[model samples]
Target: MFTDLALGALGHPRDLPTALELAARHGFGGVDPDVGHLRGLRSRTQVQELADDLTSRGLRWGIGGLPVSLTAAPAVFAEQLAALPQVAEILAAAGVGAVGTWVKPMDDALTYRRNWRLHVGRLALVAGVLDDAGIRLGLEYVGPKTFWSTERFPFVHTLAELRELIADAGAGNVGVILDTYHWYTAGETPADLRALTASDIISVDLNDARDDRERDEQQDQDRRLPGTTGVIDLSGFVDVLVELGYDGPVKAEPFLSTLAERPVDDVLAEVSDLLDRALAPAQELSRS
Candidate 1:
């Protein structure tokens, strides 16, 4: 139930120290490491050291992820799933709470049954690792691009469908990771969030969208500030989360590539200001 907002380290500096400094500077509670960015540090020692550095900085490791396409061949998906244990192990050693993933391009109903079975099996393998080490799993559903093979899939386009998937997973250690951009693009209503059960959401990534742009048009627009573009009804979103009783970090995740190119200090300050103001109450209320 803590008021935590973990900044996404996806496009930030890859070095552990730099990443930590960014999180610390931005007042983030944790770091969500993107696996691709951790390229050179593949060994157990290197990972452990990274974890240690994060701990020394008073930050927690939240999740580790890879930008994998789910629509690939079955063999390919399986190959990716097979690697989860190693990733899970590394995250555990670093004292991270969970491992998160987006659906690959190959995951359809056929692959859902296949991918689910495989994912479940792989999850079982890592569940012990997570439990013994005390970590969780966040399965975030994005657009069709994430998993196109299925007639319909859990992409957070609709909250109803997303909840069903969480129930289906049947792992106490697993849940959905909601992203505001996906919800907007899916055209789901704010009522969707109101009907949501808190148990289903494991993590939340927040960002604003532009009104005129379709989800596909902006290659990296989801990274924009909350009120800059779209008529996303920021007030409603915050109200729904309040009603749902969500008490997790509200991570700022923008894909605006240009922001990364600017000065880190300026970007951090601007992003922080945007988020703070976006959720500020329009009118003041007298205390009871």
Candidate 2:
């Protein structure tokens, strides 16, 4: 099991140096950055510089999980698409192979087709850019709280459906981001995680769920730390990962703001420690 610290875990730190320092100190193998962190980075030269910074600190470069939405205006989609290629350039130079976005289009009766068409076209275009830059695009399907909420229709939701959707978009570079939190909330079977190929799985966000409670209200309350949250079978989850041969970073992405109240270093250390414990059995199996 590999550990990677998400940028937002540092309260969305503006600069890369602070973020990178925290990541190195916390024993993260890599850092998942946002686009803003790139600053005026446009060309491969600037991207390479950032990569060098991570490499010098003995950290690997992971994907930039930017929160760009395709459900927005066509102009907004175009702007995001244009900006994404720069991210690919950054990833290519940084030796990062994966990039993802929480971009899900909403179902609007008025402009549904228009929005869908624009989204597909823009994603295909962006996928081509990522492919040219040697990066993979992880097209994440967000929960209902997001634009395209799959919460209401749990039975209808499946990775196969998403795969078909991406196929409809004709974007070969785009794949899925399997988040355990959303999977639980969406009422998906744990077996669904196995259905995806290791290659199609571009990113993984590991989080456990609480028992039946006011899920929406517990927005900050639900994301329990591994092992601390007794509701999920952590070992079973890891077994699935190993069964699927997913050697990528199984990231701990807890979104509770309460963690922010503590010292950033302490919070990071705790996250690392907790995840290490939860994933230990899996590591032993891998070594064997």
Q: What C-alpha lDDT values do all the predictions have?
A: 0.59, 0.67
Q: Identify the runs in model 1 with alpha carbons over 4 angstroms from their true place.
A: 1-11, 34-52, 66-83, 104-133, 143-157, 214-223, 278-288
| Candidate 2 residue 136 C-alpha distance from true site, Å | 0.8
Query: Which candidate leads in lDDT?
Result: 2
Over 119-177, each residue of candidate 1 has an lDDT whose tens digit, in order, gives 55554544544565566767766642333424554323345655665556566777777
Estimate candidate 1's RMSD in Å: 5.0
Which regions of candidate 2 fall more than 4 Å away from where they truly are? 10-14, 42-46, 66-68, 108-118, 144-158, 212-222
Report per-prediction Cα RMSD to one decimal.
Answer: 5.0, 3.5
- Candidate 2 lDDT by residue in tens digits, 103-198: 443453435455456667767777788799888788766443432453332221346556766887786678887776666555566587777777
